[model samples]
Target: MFAFFTRSIAAKLLVVTGVAIGLVLFLSNLVLISQTRDRVHALTMEQADAEAKSIAREVAGDIGELASAARTMAGVIGRGHEGQSFDRQGITNILKANLEQNPFAFGSWMAEEPGAIDGRKDDVKGQADLGANDDGIFTPYWSKDRNGAIQFSTFGAKYDAEWYALAAKSGKGAITAPYLAEGTDVPTTMSSIAYPVFSGGKMIGVSGVDISLLSLSDKLKALKPFETGRVLLVAQGQQWLVAPTDELLMKPYEEAGADALKTALSSGTGNLVPNLADANGEGFDRLLFPFAVPGVNTTWAVIIDIPHAAINAPVEAQTLMMIVGGLIVLGAVMMALFLAVRSIAQRPLHGLVGDVERMTKGDYASDVSNQDRQDEIGLVAKALDGFRHKLAESNMLAAEADAQRKAAEGERRRNEEERNQSASVQQHVVTALGSGLAQLSQGNLTYRIADEFPGE
Candidate 1:
């Protein structure tokens, strides 16, 4: 193929045309694909931002209910419904109603400081004495069973649980960072919102609700913006809570590199991360959309990672279309070039060949019509025409010389015949004279002189 392309003019021309067309197509496709990819990335980022915000709002609404419910119940305890002491039965009803109202709240508790509700020590009923190491704080916990039944439990005042201690000291409602809560049928992750109870300027204990995070994990798993895209909840310090699966839970999110996640968390906006690699050494260029869940103290962010291939599919399709169109145009140009070269170059050369053949046969009268065309073929025709004229002139001079020689030969022959006749006449006259002389000598000269004369 290389040799044929090197040797043949049409092949060379076609190759050149193809190469030019390919270069043009390549550049055009690059520009088009680049523009298309930009547009897609922008649009996808917008959509992802919207989705992240929507999910953020849902999470806020779900977990925010804990704080709201805890504060509402604490206000109830502070302002007694009966205008007397705090109603234990009423508080229990409120906790049951809160658990039933919000599906995300798995448990509710009201833990009081020692002697805050009743100063008498023995007034407390159903209290299980742990040991002499107790801190004397009383906590009443109400939780719903998996089958929707309300169950009661108690915690010691000196339990020293972080959520209770923080809420008790802060004297206000506060949400805890997500943590795995024990004592469930199945171990589950949860967060609690604790609101300190106060009655008449006196500090009481804390009232709060536990919001289960299992649903958040389920929501994250169900989310799929693209075929390979996923949503992850990155808590403070890059801890993964609600990721794709349980194995990914509580793992460090920075294994995929922390720069993009840090940017998203700090900026609280959508960002496009270039060529991010995963833990297993598989790299995927992704986009990050991070939004903070409202009403939470933890610096948590929701992030969405979209694969770059999802954004480039349309650009690739458009580039393929450009290549196909370029190929069609190249084919058309090649056909036109081949036809033009054949007509302008090959046909005239074939006519010159015919002229040479005729000249070889000694026939030079025919004129070459293309001699005045002003191209290389015309130059050849003109030179052939000059050779034909020269040959014709030489033939004409040869014919004239032959005619002159024949004429000279005929004149010489005529002169020679005349001389011969004259000689014959002279000979006859001499013979007559001789005969006359002989007759005279013999006495008979008058007989031949009168009848035979030289002029006759």
Candidate 2:
């Protein structure tokens, strides 16, 4: 096969064209794949950042509701009905109505210092009804259930918890860190907004509202950006406030050791980290994006783990399409080239070979058809045919000259023989005459007289 191709012009043409096409396609494919991969990666990062910002807004909405409710309650209780007069029942009624009306918050509370408002004492701790009981401190907890039922209770006199202490210690309102909400019907993590109550230029107590993390987690889980994308929330401390798996949830952030997530959280809003591997070593591409929630003091992170396969799927498809398209074009070009070579080069060369072979056998009688073709082949054919005609005419002339020379040589040989015979005859006659003269001299007169004497 190799020898045939080297010896054949058609095959060589095809091979050269194929190689040239292959080289061009290879370089083009590399450039296309590189550009496509980079473009897709950049777009993916932008999408991750957008998603992160959107989640921040949603979480802010949840936390903002609780903070707003707490502030409203705190302002009402601090001034005692718009700073007109102290009304304990009015404050209790306002708390009850807020918990019933707001779906985001499940509870509301008002805890004041002992004897700060109505000579109430903090002695009746752990009581269910603060309005009816006699207490030195004014403490009333109002909560709504899933059935929309509102109940009155008290925040026991302990007040040692971080939520209460932080509000008492800080004169302004504050939001607590995420923690598991205790005494709830369903187990879930939650946070609270605590606003300090004040009246007459003195600190009264703290008003609080509870917000759940379950709703936020549900929203995160429901996001479907990609087939294998994962949505989870991370705190600044690297804790998993909301996660897909129960084991990972509420666990220390170090357990995941997501460097990308950590970087995004530290960089604040609009930061993105792309093409990281899963913490579990699953070999999937992950993107980490973090943003700060408005009205919240903490920077939060949202991570999206997108599969490498998903990210490269479009690139692979485009590559395959280009390869197929290149092959198709190459095939078409090669086929057209083969046909042109056969007509323009191969067939003419074959005819020239036949003409030369016939000339070698001394058969020059046939006409050279390609002589008038008006191409290189025609020139070659005309030259070869001219040489053949010249050689044939010279051979005929040489043959005729050889025949004439042989005939002349035979005639000349015959003439020479006749001359020799004539000479011999003349010599014999002369010798006879000499013998007669000798006889006469010897007195042979009688013999001459008897021979019918000369001319009698």
The best candidate by lDDT is 2
What is the lDDT, from 0 to 100, of the residue 222 in candidate 1?
85
Model 2 TM-score?
0.78
Superposed model 2: Cα runs more than 4 Å off:
81-89, 114-119, 131-160, 255-263, 266-275, 279-282, 365-456
Q: Write one digit per residue (lDDT tens) for candidate 1, span 339-362.
A: 876787657777887888887887
User: What's the C-alpha lDDT at position 38 in model 2?
Assistant: 88
What value does the lDDT take at residue 139 in candidate 2?
65
What ranges in model 1 sit over 4 Å off?
A: 1-8, 120-138, 144-150, 156-160, 251-256, 259-273, 279-281, 285-290, 336-456
TM-score of each: 0.72, 0.78
Pairs of residues clashing in candidate 2: 120-135, 120-136, 121-135, 121-136, 121-137, 122-136, 122-137, 238-253
Model 2 C-alpha RMSD to native: 5.8
